[model samples]
Target chain A: METILKVKNLKKYFGRVKAIDGVSFEVEKGEILGFLGPNGAGKTTTIRCLLDFIRPSNGEIEIFGYSSRNPDFYKSRSKIGYLIAGSNLVEQWTGYDHLSYQEALHGESKIKNELIKKFSFDPKPKVKNLSTGNRQKLGLIMTLMSEPEFLVMDEPTASLDPILQEEFYKIIRKLSSEGVTVFMSSHNLAEVEKVCSKVAMIKSGKLITVQKISALEGKKIHSVKITFSEKVSKDLLVDKNTEIQEEIPNGFELSVKGEMDAFIKKIAKLKIESISIMQANLEEIFLEFYKK
Target chain B: MIAIIKRALRDRFIPFISYSIGGIVLVWMYIALLPSVQQSQVQLQDVMKAMPEGLMKALGVSGVNLASLEALLAMKQYNMIWPLLMIFFIVSFAGGMIAGEVENRTIEIVLSSAKSRAKIFFSKYLSGIIYLILFVVATTLCAIPMAKLYGYEYAAPNYYTLMYLSLCFGLAVYGLSILFSSLFSSRGKVYGISGILFVAMYVLFILVSLKDSLKNLQYISFFYYYNINDALIHNKIDGLSVFVFLSIGLIASLLALIIFLDRDFAV
Candidate 1:
């Protein structure tokens, strides 16, 4: 697959404070890459650098094969769509005014009406009068109206209701299927996991890891809790990858990584009353990364 | 670019029309009183002679013959009243040009488009120039028709010179305010800095005009370069003054664009 966005060794500093430290990642064509981080973890800073709104103190960003530092990089913006986290719309302007301005810049948006209907946004009221959720809906419609090749959003669904968030995910999925590259930052791990194919985790201005969602879910980390009728030696299930979370008189809560076959066989030799195995979800993996 | 300009002009439409009509009516009302003032020229001259030279200069009525309609209009309209009005409008309008957008976070929307920063700056700057021209033209050009309505012999060339000087002055004020606008994100900061700067310059101009020993420092004030008396009464357009105004305007505007292009919109 072709890479649509590339960030390498990116560092941004405000005075002596490093906002983004040696962060690097890539998004391939037609891929939905979710940028996951806590508040002030350099997600917005990285996005700003990617959009060339702010210059990086070190390293570089390349979008569509053009260096972001290039003076002509603005030419590539025509194919990019952006949605700021909050209501960045003009307070005095109606939704129609914003749409008309965008249409004037690019051609008329063919899917403008469809996105508005899907979001159930009313474009007649001035933005100042719109509620926060309605304002987010308008911003979402604006980002998707032009049908850009690459979409960069900052906390795109931070204010959307659950149903609207689900609808937004469907639109993102549909857009990705049509070969649109999406890179969005969100603290909502569930939202990211629902739509994004890959996730890049960032913490304290550093990238923890970037991996496929499926790969993260298939990490072979499982929580096993076994209640045996009789007391068993803790050494019986001894394995390098297995961690005993809790010790009881007749039970053990084990967190096993990788294969469970040997542990299952070992436990089978002993009498077991009840056994429960729960697979690790993305949230658990995210928490583990944060803990580290 | 045109759309951006249109949006800017549309946003400022109410203020533009209000100020234009206010300026025209103000000029016309001052002209309406001209005939009576001219009729009492001797009495006014006596009163001017009784006033101290320093006080007269401070009032912008000392250096010129008060008998002339142009001199009376310059003293009454352009001297303190009209400039105060123009400064208020320029500071409020140009202060919001760039800083207001950034403060409201609407600049991100504009920057998200394909246009370069230069294009956006010029588009908004161009809208301001349009308003400035309209204000200056409406206020200055009406003097000719207004004097004609009062049956006073007024020179058209004098008002034309006034228009030229006024445009340059407006541009200078606009440049100063916009430069501050580019540097600060808050419109209130822009207003405060530009307001204090203008007040200082006006005070300096008044001091130099009042005291001959302070004459050397007169050149520091834009008010000195304005030379409204020469433009109106003498029908003289000083090339140096024009150059200074245009230079300040161009340099400030250029610096504004440069700073705006390099500025990082934090969050």
Candidate 2:
């Protein structure tokens, strides 16, 4: 796949406070990169640098193969679409007026009506009167209207209702299938796990790890459920190969990593009534990464 | 760029009409009542003598030859209220241009469009210029019949110098305000800083005209170059004054565009 966006050693500092400290990542074409981080972890700041709205204190960026630091970068950036987190649109104008104003500059919107209907919305009401979900829907319409090839959204689903969130997932899935590149940040781990093929974990303004969900799934980690016929001491059950995940009544849920054959044989020798094994899910792996 | 102009024009339509009509009527009212005031010239002069010096100076009464229609108009409208009205309009427009979007968080939407920051800045500035030009033209045209009816003997204004100087003054004020707008995200701060600076500068001009000690500070105030009264009444172009205002305006505008190019929209 072609690299649609690349950031090398990106850094941003505000008066000695490092907002983004040497963060680096690359996003491939037709891929949805889920940027996951805790609040104030430089997600939005990094997005701003990518969009060229703010200059990075150091490092380089290339979007669609053009250096973002160049003077004429915006000539290429105009094709980018974005939905700002917690955007406060003009209150006096109707939703239609706002959309029309944006469309007038960006040209026609391909999915205007479809998205509007899907959201079950009319753009007639004053923006201030619209509920948060409706306002987010309006912003989504504006962002997706131009049918842009590259999209960067910050917390896109935070304000969306569950049904709209599902619809949003479907829309992004369809867009990605059509070869659009998306780089989005969100706190919704489930949504990210559902839609994003690769998740980039950010912590303290640094890129900690970037892993594919399927690749993480292939790790030799399994959830072992065992019901003991008699009480088993925690110290005896836990070895160098396995960690007790949770303690149940007369049972223990253990996470057995690779080379657990010896651990399993030892477990069978104990008072074990029945044992069940299941693959570790993405959520469990994500939690491990997130907590780190 | 086209979108910016289109939206700006649409938003300013009603305001343009209100200001243009308000200007015409105001100019006409002052011109229409000139003869009666002229008749009371002797009494007015006597009353002026008894008034406080500061009040008279604020009204620009000290420099005017009360016997002439041009001087009377200058004292009452041109030098005082006309510029005040223009400043009111330009101040609001400039203060709101960039900062208003930041305040309302609409800039992210606009910036995400195909246009660059420079294009957006220039588009909005161009719209303001077009409005200012059209406004000046409307008021100039509207004043013809009123001047003829009230003061047929009033000296003809130097149209060439007047238009250039007025535009330059408008540009200067608007440019300064835009500079302030570019520096801050809050529209209220823009309004507050620009408005206070405008008044403070004008007050400095008053001191230059009235106090010997403060006369040297005239070069710093925009009002010093905005001598529309002398330009119209005395036929004095004051090329230096025009250059000063135009230079300040152009420099300020350029600074604003450059600063905003990389300024982060924190929200």
Model 1 docking tier (incorrect/acceptable/medium/high): medium
The CA lDDT of each predicted structure is 0.87, 0.80
In model 1 chain B, the worst 10-residue window by lDDT is: B54-63
Score every model by TM-score: 0.93, 0.90
DockQ score for model 2, please?
0.58
- Candidate 1: stretches off by over 4 Å: A226-275, B39-43
lDDT digits (tens) for residues A1-292 of candidate 2: 7998999999999988898999888989899999988898899889988877778899999988778778777766666888854457777779898889978988878778887888888899998898888889888888888898998998899888889899999999999999998999988788888999888888878888887867766767788988899988989878766889899878889988776688778887798887889877776776666665
lDDT of 1 by residue, B1-267 (tens): 898899889989988888888888988887888778878888988888998797677666886777677898789888777788888898889877788878887888888888887898899899999999999999888899878877888878999999999999999899988999888888999999998998999999888877899999889898888877888988998999999999999999899889888888653
Q: Give the best candidate by TM-score.
A: 1
Note each model's CA RMSD in angstroms: 2.6, 3.0
Please give the TM-score that candidate 1 achieves against the real structure.
Answer: 0.93
Q: Write the per-residue lDDT of candidate 2 for residues B1-267, one digit (tens) a residue.
A: 888998887877778788878877887887777778879899989988987685576566765668765667667766767787788777677767788887777777777776878888898888888888887766644555667775556655554456667777888888888888888888889888887888898889877666878878978888777776666666787888878888888999899998898788764
lDDT, model 2, position B135: 74
